[model samples]
Target: MCYYLKLKYFTLHGPLPGMPPQFLLGNLAQSGLLFDKASLPEAHIAFKQRYGDIYQFWISSTRLIVVNNLNDIQHIFTHRNIYDQGDIYVQKFSIVIPHGLISSKGAKYKRHAGLTLPLFRRGKIVSNFDLIVDCVDKLLIRWRTKSPQHVHLDIVQQSQNLLLAIFGLIGFDYDMETLDNDNDTNKNELTKALQYFLSNFNIMLFSPKILSTIYFKLSSQYRQSQKTIEQYFDRMIKQELDNGKELIAQRKRTSLIASLVGSLQQDEEMETNKSEEDRKGLSRNELLDEMRLFLLAGFETTSTALAWFIHLMSKHPQVQQNIKTELSNNNSQGLLSLDRLDSLVYLDCVIKEVFRFCPPINGTVRTLTVDDRLPETGAQLFRGDQILIPFHSLARDTRYWSIDPELFYPERFLGADKDHHPYALIPFGGGHRQCIGQDLARFELKVIAARLMQYVTFGDGGNQVNSGGHLSKLTIIPKHVGVTIDFDK
Candidate 1:
């Protein structure tokens, strides 16, 4: 690979460092290095050894520049017009969520972002505080059955179930009613549908185009799973349209339904084709797309983050006790107030450290919309070239850290890494492409972590059981998240 004369892309500008395209099988054979769909964080680490920080590789017919450099990543994100969301990603996600935030771009992306932004803002999240607490309390009541003695829990799996149920009751007014069940198979019908989708999501999204095409052709199961998501989404959208107001009457607070309807009403893209009287904000498919975005993304990423927080807390009992102490010292009158949560500075640090330590999302992709050169490297980027900004690399990179970035130490957030590069610890990404539901995700995680600390102690399940290695699919999930719950009496 060091031999420039032997390099296939030597003529292409930029640093040409990486395994020499595997010669015959190309980067496809070394796909594990390019991007490990099964275990991305470690794979990215390995790629750093072979490819260095920024390098080029071939994924089937596509040319990709995988970068972990903070400046290059920030440039791609900040210059939105020059680098757009990869259309391949849009195409892949559109299979399940058409015109949704992940699938749509330009005007459609703005429309979705604008309507949902206010719904997840800090104020709106505060309003939903009680509902989130109620959800966690339900889990606590069930955990009471296993109190006094420690019971092993697959906390990652459990958090997924819990967050799904909470989203149902809060966002869509549908009760999952799965909290009482001991069996994974015994779930609400809608929950079951989601489980089916999760179980059979397209692994093809990460594969080479040739391999993915072959996989898609052979599997009707993948298509069926997509249909399952669409069917569940459309039904929910209809139910919200018909009885959303009545459902929210029980809460007396605004439901996310209003945003869906508002977007639906103001959507006038098809107005020129339809009569002046028949303009609609979102078509039926568009409404379903937004619902898919809210439901899937709303629950899954947060649950993974919370799961990582718990897994890390179990390993660091001293840190956990500090959070408990902070909770006690800050506890006062109006239960579950954001002010109270804000007072727990240590808990906030632990949360940031958890995000830094185990970011659920591996990274994101963008396509160069025009030919350009990177600021520092002067690398040539042709229009439509792909850029993979590895989130795990940036978070774990030692260059930007005053404290050792490798440790699970939260105090780094308080002292040494206080002025760390803004782009370094971004688990949710940045600029125009940032996740819209971050405020709500943080709110849910904080209240839930506080409630758990108040009610139970997450005992470390030892090195074998609590061993942390990520199982990277779409999200970087803990490979083994076993923890023993010691219920607080």
Candidate 2:
């Protein structure tokens, strides 16, 4: 009776249907969010089926209206002012990177986005083709060291190393040497710090606010990780600022750090006229936060996607062959240049299909700023309500696809579903606050994937190990990606 009364009290303003929430526990106890009953993606899919496209989800006392409909999502995404940064997402990321674009709001977010987005433009990313190719080739060489008879590879680790190396060089012009066996303490320390931070950050997201705060304050590992990250990024910032004037004057460099530092330099030069509120550049602390965000985002998403790609390729030998054949027809010398990579159109479709099939990010959350009604379902949304737009749900919805959304076919992009609704396959998300580094992520994935297909064939390690499942963390990664690598002469 108390539960019913409490629920009724909360639902006075038009309630959306959802499973009954337990006192204090909300729906989490039954939602399987922190349990083994179902992965996050699976749980969401089940929720959509049980409660229809639009429903209410409670994480503890916080209410999130989960919307799976494409039209509503499109509306929410299009109206940037109505649906701003997600409360949970911002709260979670703010603890680690308060001034970073992911966590910061309003002026701070605008400042970071203005200074940062230009560095990731498609032209700039394309220009780094040689650098990316070099990184991928290093991985290929490392893989080649293994004998074909004992070629069962841990692709997850390999992908992480490859992406880390690429992003390190591209973002900061720093050589992490993650791909090599270099034992530089500083490099390895950065790697360890980043891993520790991410793992704990994920934990904090699942934990209650007070518990998360207590953990952050008391955890020695967390403190150490924070210290290491600060020290390393400070050093990078100082190095860039030391050469900031030259970098800005030349305007030839395109590394993320350089661009950010150049902004700072420009800000300093023009500080006499402009007020602090109107300043275009980020502060040193803000720059450090952004760097941390970049390093984590740059490697984590792409690496997880690559892991899934490897797992999928292992299961689909014919798809691998098709990509290889496309590459062959494009480049006879087996070289993976930017032009060659672009010419492999089928491979492009495959990459898109990979994103559509199992996106690294399952959903993007948006917090409502005004009380409004959803266009399709007519569910009333209150101010401060966070709505989750599930990308996986949209990708799999039968209404959106002409080809069966259940089937993982790359050719779907080439045929009837070629002109699928723009909102139907938003892996990087939509709207103004969509991923700033999407072009870079896509370019890196294509380059690494193409280079891998050039010299290696990934074979299924069998159902015992190669069975498909996802481990939900910062990204949806393949849980079992054991694959045999065959090197082609």
Model 2 Cα lDDT, one tens digit per residue, 305-332: 8998998898888999999888888356
Off by over 4 Å in 1: 1-15, 21-38, 57-62, 147-153, 208-235, 244-254, 262-280, 330-335
Each model's backbone clash number: 2, 0
Clashing pairs in 1: 264-281, 267-281
Query: Where in model 2 is the C-alpha error above 4 Å?
Result: 1-13, 151-153, 182-187, 242-244, 248-253, 264-276
Model 1 Cα lDDT, one tens digit per residue, 221-301:
656655766676666667766765555344333567655754454444655477534444566567777777788888889
Displacement of residue 33 (Cα, Å) in model 2 is 2.1
Q: What is the lDDT of candidate 1?
A: 0.73
